[model samples]
Target: MTRVLITGATGQVGRELVEVFADLEVTALDRAHLDVTHRDDVLDVVRRLRPHVVVNAAAWTDVDGCESDPERAHRVNAESVRWLTEATREVGGHLCHISTDYVFDGTARRPYREDDATNPRSVYGRSKLAGELELDPSATLVRTSWVFGRYGSNVVGTVLRLLDAGAPLRFVDDQVGCPTEAYDLALTIRGLVDARHAGPVHVTNDEPMSWFGFVQRVAAAAGGDPEQVEPIQTADLVPPRPAPRPPYSVLDGSLLHSLDTTAPGDLDRAIERVVAAMRSTVKR
Candidate 1:
């Protein structure tokens, strides 16, 4: 039996990972059980569990918060990953670290390749990129974008809530990226772990869309009026954020194809699934 350990178990991706790896001897830990910022606690847990695989799903994801508190972001995103990597190395366990498409500057005319230069504009992206660099040969880094799922707060949920409240929705049209489903991303990670594939990989849905388009799709799926969702350029939504976001951050997962890996669903199907899941939850 392969023993697998996951941090940020209560998060969107981590929650999905627990469900996907349910058959395995999986130990899921949330912030309370495993505070990644505490090096001693991280090392002690890894030494005791001695898992064959460690999936790090915890991250400082608040884009604006990272800009205000860069030190905390570094502690959570970079330093904690280093500690986890060291612990995993000591235990002879392979690490799977989650990353983001924000690593790229989004200036590419097409999707970003694995080897493309990363010039992250935000503190969150920089910290995540730093974590990726720290892992090197010992870990597999999976970069994804526009993540949404049933387990936690995501774009889909926010859009639905706004629609329900009859609040006018305004989404940025300038930004574009693959809207990845957390469940699909989690399953892809499971495949990599099971197959023992190494190195960095990009896993996202087949298509890319602007934030406005995504909201339109979500609204349509939820039986809401798509026209009510307004599309606006990022520039109009100022006071401007503390950190800069990439205008285009789509990641190409062609490398995963060589490894015989396939993304689960496309954007349309992912939206349908999210809508169905949300409806089911509401009915319950």
Candidate 2:
């Protein structure tokens, strides 16, 4: 059986990845079991098991928190990649790294291609881009945006919760990007691993829409009133966020097309699946 080791196994994407790779000899390590930030521990464990592939889902994903603690962000997000890459290389294993569309400044009117020049605006984005730079040339780099899933707290959940509580929802309408489902991204990662596809690949839903639009869709998907989501400019947010977001972080799946690998289907359908799953879990 193929041996696969998943770091951050309890994360949004990691949880789904663990389920999808059930047929494989997979070692799923949550942060409590394996701290990727600890270089010696990572090397020790990776050298011992020497799995055929290392899927790194570990990251410091709190954008605003990263702004307040850039050093911690570097340690968790960027330095971990370096350690994992070194260890994976020692074992002659393939490394599949997760990245974000935040690497770009989001100033462009057109979608960002795989090879596009990156200009990250926030500390979180800069740190993630640093991790991208640390990857082995042959390693797979998957960049996605606006990810939501059942395993973690995400925008979808926040929207649903706020709506359920009758709280006024104000979302930025200026920033636009793809709302990628974690389950779909995990499936794409599995396919890429099987094919041994290397280099950076942009994976996201086909459509690009505003954050306001996304919340509206989430409201609709969860049987809430979409009109309750008030569309506002980024500047209008009270007690403004610490980290700056890109106005346009839409990723182009042209590489997927060029490689003949179809990106996941529409965002609406993905939202429906996620909402349904969330409801099912709640009912149980």
Candidate 3:
């Protein structure tokens, strides 16, 4: 039996990974159990467990927060990843790290390929890119975008809450990317682990859409009035966010598709599943 150690076990991706890889000798660790930012702690845990794989799902995901505290972000995203990779390599274990689509500058007219030039516009992106570069050949770097799921706070959850509160929502139409479901992403990760596929792979839902279009779909799926969801440019909405967002960061899923490892759900079906799951949680 393969022993797998998962970091950020309480997170959306980590939770889904735990559920998907239940058959494996899985030791799920949150920050309480293992702090990746602490090199000694990470090294100690890996040496103690001696697992076959280390899947790192823990990340400082607050994009705006990263802009304000780049140093902390680097510690959490880049330095921690390097530590984990080195630890895993020392133990002859594979490291599976999750990354974001923000690595791209979003200037591409079409979807971003895996080998495309990475020009990160924000601190979060740069940190994630650095993390990716630190991984060894045994590691798998999975890049996704607009991720949401049932485990924790996400864009879908936030939108639903706003709609339930009868608040007018204005989403930026200028920004575009694939809205990925964490469940699908988790399954894809499991597939890659099982197959021992290495290198950077882009994993996301099949379709891409603007934030306004995505919000509209979410509202419609959640039984909200779509007309109430307004469209605006990124410049129109001024939130006190610290980072600048990519105008377009849609990732090309062709690479994963060629390997027959692409996600099953598209944007429409993904939204439906998310809405159903959220509604079930509310009823409970």
Candidate 4:
């Protein structure tokens, strides 16, 4: 069995990755077991276990929190990857790192390819890009966007909650990007790992839509009123967000053509599956 170690096992993607790689000799660790930010601990764990692969899903994903504390952001997102790279080197293991679309400034007219120049606009984006820089060319970097799943926090649950509560729904129509289900993303990752794919590759639905569009789809999939979602602009946000978001951060799987990988499953069907799964566990 191929030895695989997964970090941040409690996260949405991390959880799905655990399930997807279940057939392997998998060891999943949550933040409690392994804090990637601590260099010595990271080195010790990788050296001790000596897994063939280290899938790093651990990241300080608090975008607003990152803006407030750039130091912690750099440590968790950027510096952590640096340490992981070193540790993986010692073990001679393949490092498969999850990345985000925020690496780009989101201004391009076309979809973002793997080789496009990056101009991260926020602390989170900058830190993530820094993490990407820490990797060797042979390491696998998977970039995705607008991810939702059955676990943890996501827009799918948020939309369902508001719909269930009969609250007014409003979302921005200005920001456009692709939505990726965590389950499908894991499948894509599994393929990449098996192929020993190197360099950056985007994993997302081919088409892009506005945030308002995504919310409507989620509502429809959850048996709620899709039309109930009120479309608004970024400027219409009452308090405004702390971090700068890309207006058009849709990632195109152009590199997928060259690689032995496929994009995630259909967007609508994936949303329906997640919505159904989430509904089953709803508080009675």
Candidate 5:
């Protein structure tokens, strides 16, 4: 049996990875059980398990919050990655690290390639980029965007909650990127691990669309009124957020194209499944 260790096992992507990797010998550790910042704990765990692969799904994702405390953000997002990478290397296991589209500044009109020059705008992006930089050349890096799914708070879940409360929604129309489902991302990571693919790969549901369009799809999936969701410019946010978002975050599908890996299904279809799963739990 293949032994796979998953860090950040309580996170949205991590949770899905745990479920999907049930057939494998999986040892999942949430923040409580395995804090990545502590090098001793991380090294000890990896040395003990000696897993074939280590999937790092943990990250400090609070964009605006990262600005408030850059130190903490770096510690959680970047510094901890250093220790994790070292630990993974010590165990002679391949590391699969999760990254974000934020590694790029939103200036590019075309989709960003893996080799593209990185210039992150916010502290969160810089920290994540630092994590990417710390990875061993042999480690696999998966950069994803606009993730939503069953285990944690995400754009889809937020829209559903607001719709349930009958709260008016106004999403930014200027910002656009791929909307990825956590389950799909987890499956893709599994394939990459099995193949031991190295270097950065972009994984997201196909097509590029704004958050407004995404919310509309979510509303429709949840059997709510899509037209009720309003569109607004990023500047029009009532209370401005602290971190700046990339206006165009579409990552180039070049790597996925070269590998001939099938892209995840349409964003709307994934949204429907996520909504359905959420609804099932509400009734029980």
Candidate 6:
């Protein structure tokens, strides 16, 4: 069995990774156990384990919080990645790090490609880009957008919660991107890790739509009326968001095909599964 070391194992993606890699020899660790920002500690852990692959799923993902604390964001997102790169090198292991579509400044009319020029507009995006720069082409860099999953706080869960409570749904129509199911993404990551794929790659669900449409889809999947979702512009936000999200973040998933792979099945099917699973837990 392939030995895999996963950081941020408690996160949405991290949790799904653990579940998907159940057959493998996996060592999953959370921030409390392994503070990746500490260089010596990260090096010590990797050097000791010497796993075949080290999946760095840990990240400071609070976009607005990153804007307020740029230094902390760089430390966790960029500096920690440098440490992980060095550690993985010491063990002669493949490093699979997760990245965001936020690296691209939402200005492209066409889908963003792997080689597209990146101009991140917010502190969080800039920090993530810095981390991406730390890796050589030998490492696998997966850039995804609008990621959601069953294990953590995500837009999917948020929508379900609001719908269950009979709350209003207001979403921005201007910002568009792909929604990635974490379980499927984890499966792709496993494939990449097994193949020891190198270079930057984009992975996301099939459909590309705006946030408003996405919320409506979620509401519909949860047995709520899609029309109940209020469409609003980004500028109409009462208290403006701290970080500026990309207006268009649909990635060119064609890169996955080049790697002899493809995105998982239909996005609507995935959404329905998530909705069913979430609803099952609701108290009658």
Give each prediction's root-mean-square deviation over alpha carbons: 1.2, 1.1, 1.2, 0.9, 1.1, 1.1
Candidate 3 lDDT by residue in tens digits, 1-284: 99999999999899999998899999999999999999999999999999999999999999988998999999999999989998999999989999999999989998999899999999999999999999987688899999889879998888999998998898989899988899999999998887777999999986889989989999999999888889998888776356878889999988898885545467678789988998899989
What TM-score against the true fold does each predicted structure earn?
A: 0.97, 0.97, 0.97, 0.98, 0.97, 0.97
lDDT of 6 by residue, 82-185 (tens): 99999998888999999999999999999999999999999999999999999968999999989877778889888988987889999999999999988889
- For model 5, residues 77-108, the per-residue Cα lDDT tens digits are 99988998899888789999999999999899
Worst 10 residues of 1 by lDDT: 260-269
Instruction: Please tell me which model should have the higher TM-score, number 3 or number 4.
Output: 4
Q: How does candidate 3 fare on TM-score?
A: 0.97
Off by over 4 Å in 5: 260-262
Regions of candidate 2 where Cα sits further than 4 Å from its true position: none
Best TM-score goes to which candidate?
4
Q: Which tens-of-lDDT digit does each residue in 92-184 have in candidate 1?
A: 999999999989998999999989999998899999988898895847889889899987888999998899899999999999998989998
Pairs of residues at least 3 apart in sequence or in different chains that clash in candidate 4: none
| Candidate 2 local lDDT, 1-284, one digit each (tens) | 88999999999999999988889999999999999999999999999998999999999899999999999999999999999999999999999999999999999989999999999999999999999999998999999999998879999888877877899999999999999999989988998888888999999986899999999999998988888889999999889999999999999988886775546887888999988888788789
Query: Residues 183-265, candidate 4, lDDT per residue (tens digit)?
Result: 99999999998888998999997669999999998898888888889999999898999998999999988787567675687
> lDDT values of the candidates?
0.90, 0.92, 0.90, 0.93, 0.91, 0.90
Residue 85's lDDT within candidate 1 is 93
Residue clash pairs of candidate 2: none
Q: How does model 2 fare in lDDT?
A: 0.92
- Model 3: runs farther than 4 Å from truth? none
Instruction: For model 5, give the RMSD to the true fold.
Output: 1.1
Worst 10 residues of 6 by lDDT: 275-284
